[model samples]
Target: MNLSLEITGLTKSYADSGFMLDNVSLAIPSGTIMGFVGENGAGKTTTIKSILNTVQIDSGTIRLLGKEMTDRDTALREDIGVVLDSANFSAILTPGKLAKVMRGIYRQWDQELYVRLTDKFALPMNRKIKEFSRGMTMKLAIAAAMSHHPKLLILDEATSGLDPITREEILEVFLEFVEDEHHAILMSSHITSDLEKIADYITFIHQGKIILTAMKDELIYDYGVARCTSDQFRRIAEGDRLAYRVKEHQTDVLVKDRRGFGQQYSGIMVDQVSIDEILLLLVKGEN
Candidate 1:
């Protein structure tokens, strides 16, 4: 399978914070939307910085579109569109003026596409970026990112600061972008619901480590939460337990093969797990 982005042992650290990214590794396949998820300060931003060459890593390798990433890979960068949490444009420049600046920077910048997206997102073209609301700023950033016709899009909290309706509109545009089969996205967001809606695969990180990387369907359908009494929980095989938490009189165990466990333990209640629940269980539960 063709990979849009690949990272192996991508390690980075600072003197004060210790390890920010510890042996981090993941892959984004072509035409796939990979949800990069984690709690705050879980190294998601660090990993992204490593991939973008914004931060020098202490160790490991990063490959973008099959080529090893380098500090001076401007050619490779042109094919990758990025939208970080904050807008990175001059506050005085309007969207119209920013488009002209982008046209000079990106060889493949599409002015028409930029205009359409700005209009679709209801971003005002007449006002300076400083005067725009947080949502409008984010929309402008996304519009600029898409106008470049990038093969791979990297979005860090791109849907943040938007109303539900606007978020849905942006999500639709993202879904349409990946329909071309040549495009891929690596979106990092705190919004699990957004990821659940459109991500093909989910890679969850915690405390500078990857907890899980699996298909969205497999995560939702194959894995489950088995609620059982403490006695019943003790009877379960150690290998079948992914994570567990003790309640008042019961224990909720996360199992990888829910159906198999269900067949084996008919008395235990195997409940469907949502991405949010899975994340909570994994982060808070014990193995």
Candidate 2:
């Protein structure tokens, strides 16, 4: 399989805050979306900054487009479109002027595509970016990112505040972009429901460390939460449970297989787990 982005032992730290990206690593394969899951301070943005080489790293390797990535590799960046939590475009430039600037920067910039995207998103061509609402700014940013037809997209909180209809429209564009086997995406989002819709893989990060990485279907379909009394919990094998939390009268355990656990422990109730439940279990529960 062709990998669009690959990281190995990627580590970084800040002196004053003492937050470190400890041994961070993951891979994004071509034609697939990797949903980066984490809490606000779980090193999601830090990891992304490291990938962009905007922050200096203490250790590890990062490869983009099958080649080693460095801050100096300006050429490689043209192939990757990024939308951070907020739009970073100039305040004074209108979408029309911004398109002109983009035309100067990207050798392969498509004017027709830019116009189409802008029109589709209902962005005003003459309106200054500073005058736009948060959602409008976000839509303009995304439109700009895709105008040049980048092969990889790195979006952090890209879909956060958009309305359902707009989000659904943008999501369709994303799905269409990856129809070619050479495209891929690494989207960092708090919206698990959005990830559930489009992401092929899910990587969970907590406190600067990667805790879990699995196929979306496996995490959703195969994994489960086993709820039982403390007495029954003792009967569960050590290997059977991934993590567990104790409630007042019962214990909730995270098990890898819903059907298998139900069959093994006949009376214990094993229910299907969602991404949010999985995050709660892995972060709050203990083995």
TM per candidate comes to: 0.97, 0.97
- Local accuracy of candidate 2 as per-residue lDDT tens digits, 76-99: 888989889977799999999999
Regions of candidate 1 where Cα sits further than 4 Å from its true position: none
lDDT of 1 by residue, 1-287 (tens): 99999999988998796767889999999999999988888888888888898988999988899998786788888899999998779999999899989999999899999999999988888899999988889889999999999999999999987888878988998999999788999999989889999999999899999999999999888999999998899899989999999989899999998999999988999998988888888888998
Model 2: lowest-lDDT 10 consecutive positions = 67-76
Predictions in order: lDDT: 0.91, 0.91
For candidate 2, the clash count comes to 0
Candidate 1 at 86: error in angstroms?
A: 1.1
- Residue 60 in candidate 2 has what lDDT? 93
**Whole-model alpha-carbon lDDT for candidate 1:** 0.91
Per-residue lDDT of 63 in model 1:
89
lDDT of 2 at 232: 95
Residue-level error in angstroms, candidate 1, position 114:
0.5
Name every residue pair that clashes in candidate 2: none
